[model samples]
Target: MPSQGKLYVVGIGPGCEEMLTLRARKVLESSDYVIGHRTYLNFVRHLVRGSIVESGMGREVERVKMAVELASGGHVVSLVSGGDPSVYGLASLVAELVYRNGLELDYEIVPGISALNSASPLFGSAISGDHAVISLSDLLTPWQVIERRLRKALEGDFVIAIYNPSSRRRAGNLRRAMEIVIEYRGDCFVGVAKNVCREGEQVLVMRASEVAESGVVDMHTLLIIPSTESIVDGNWIITPRGYSRKYELEVE
Candidate 1:
């Protein structure tokens, strides 16, 4: 065993064991201490031979600090996050704390499939074109900033994938987002993928107007609002990547 310990910020990939990358699994197996949110830890608990540390939401800083301290003490640590760590995950937190404190530590970020990746296929090729992923949760980001981003992305006609569309505390945020959607692209195809790769997975493709009217969404839901040029065809949301526009196509 090495004398020095290292930190690995691992993404477990949307709560599915199969979605866990090989590097992520190796890092988890090699860890002396595995720390992460309780729900994310449960997904890879089977592969973790080390001691597991569980924390609930809003304790991200505490978890990263504990992992750092453990690593500094010569213990290899794996800080787990659901989905790709770079995308709204714990990797940035680890980096900020380490750099800000000027701590001498070795760390690596192992990427994994994000919720956007896992949820994309449920809507066919909805994300095949230019797309924007925005989280509707205004906990860290201001709602005004979110609205501005939504407006700009929709104006540019980028397919928009919304994360954290709603929560018990912020149930109206998704409605607010839909209002913006209506303003830019009215009654467009909207795909909702809930629970993603986890159990109780549900997928729905509906008109933007319908989604706005029903207001059926939650924190677990990912809403894919396709560009105005896209359309719903035979239960699939297809966003063309400009191929038909360039080439002469014939029906076979």
Candidate 2:
């Protein structure tokens, strides 16, 4: 058996190649093996060399095992995930696998832009205050847990960013979420960003009441719900009173 090597879990940002950070690009070019879902693999095809493993949907565990196995055989492996590695990405699973298997290997997580950050600028300052990120897919988690979190977000008056809001089989969750939020915040700000950082990106900024009627959002879309204090500012929507000014003072 070959000596084990290091594993680098890299985030490729959203879907745009240009959005890829310099370190992520470097790791991809230098790694001996690359592993990721088909779409994510396609996104970084140009940057990768050596052997590449393309895992399709519903095969995440298998993909992680493959990457670990390759790395255990002395191959420098780079595992790619979309958005931030820590946010609904494969980093946690990979770490769990390594611990369970009792494999001694070095690994690092490279951060990248999450959908929330990518979509935030579209809606004027929706996340200027405190907020939460929730994934509505309910694959690993139960729907009840998701609902509870949604309720907390509403009651706390926190801006919320929802990922995997709707899919073909789970199409009505977003509407349900809006219904719950409306009960707490009668009329709030809502923004939808579709295919962010991709070629056909579109941003829609509207009232939360209008989101259900807009019929323009999808699974690829990210929903940003602004706090009560958020407001629209021309084409650039943002949350005011950022911490930058709080820390930086003007010199006389």
Candidate 3:
């Protein structure tokens, strides 16, 4: 029996080549096959020296199965994902498939800069403290569950980072999210980071009440809804991580 080749689950980051990790780049360049969603594949097409297998958004299972088949045949494979693979990416799916099938596959997961990592800097310490990352897309998960999570996170005063907030078909989701946020926090600051590190990048800090009317959010947008303790200082939204209450510091 031929030895099974290694499968590398590589995170390509937010479409910024410089933000791509060295390990991820090396995996893409050295692998005999590179497989991923078409959008993510375009992000690192320049680095892939191997045969490319690109599929559409809803074809994740197909992509992973193809990658696994190639790797099982002694071909090194790199499965690319946007943002950190473990965070709402393909790493979990691949692991599930391998475990459920009882396949002994040699695999590794490479982390990369996620949207929150790339977008938070634009908000200037908006999520410096304890936070909750939630996805608004109800494709796989029910909306009621997502709403309950949002309410609980808000009630606990946790800063929240919302991903996949809205899209063409799910336009009302973000608006409803903003409503829930406003109910708990009473019109708090909501940071909208659109197309982070990509073309037409935009960062805006607006009130949660206004988010419903602003019409700025989309699928590419990541929201940073600060805790009640957070304050808007000049051009930045700063979340107080209890540093001042714990220690006395002289300000110049």
Give one digit per residue, the lDDT tens place, for model 3 in 132-210. 9999999989999999999999999898999998888987998899888888878777888998998989999888888
Which scores greater on TM-score, model 1 or model 2? 1
lDDT of 2 by residue, 138-207 (tens): 8888999999999998778677899988877776787788888788888666778989988679887777
Q: Tell me how candidate 1 scores on lDDT.
A: 0.86
Which of the two, 1 or 2, has more lDDT?
1
Ranking according to lDDT, highest score first: 3, 1, 2
Per lDDT, the best of the predicted structures is: 3
Model 2 Cα shift for residue 27 (angstroms): 0.5
User: Model 3: what TM-score?
Assistant: 0.95
Evaluated at residue 82, the lDDT of candidate 3 is: 91
CA lDDT, every prediction? Answer: 0.86, 0.83, 0.88
Clashing residue pairs in candidate 2 are: 124-237, 124-238, 125-237, 125-238, 125-239
Model 2 lDDT, full chain set: 0.83
Q: State each candidate's clash count.
A: 0, 5, 0
Q: Estimate each model's TM-score.
A: 0.94, 0.89, 0.95
Give Cα distance to truth, residue 136, candidate 3, Å. Answer: 0.3
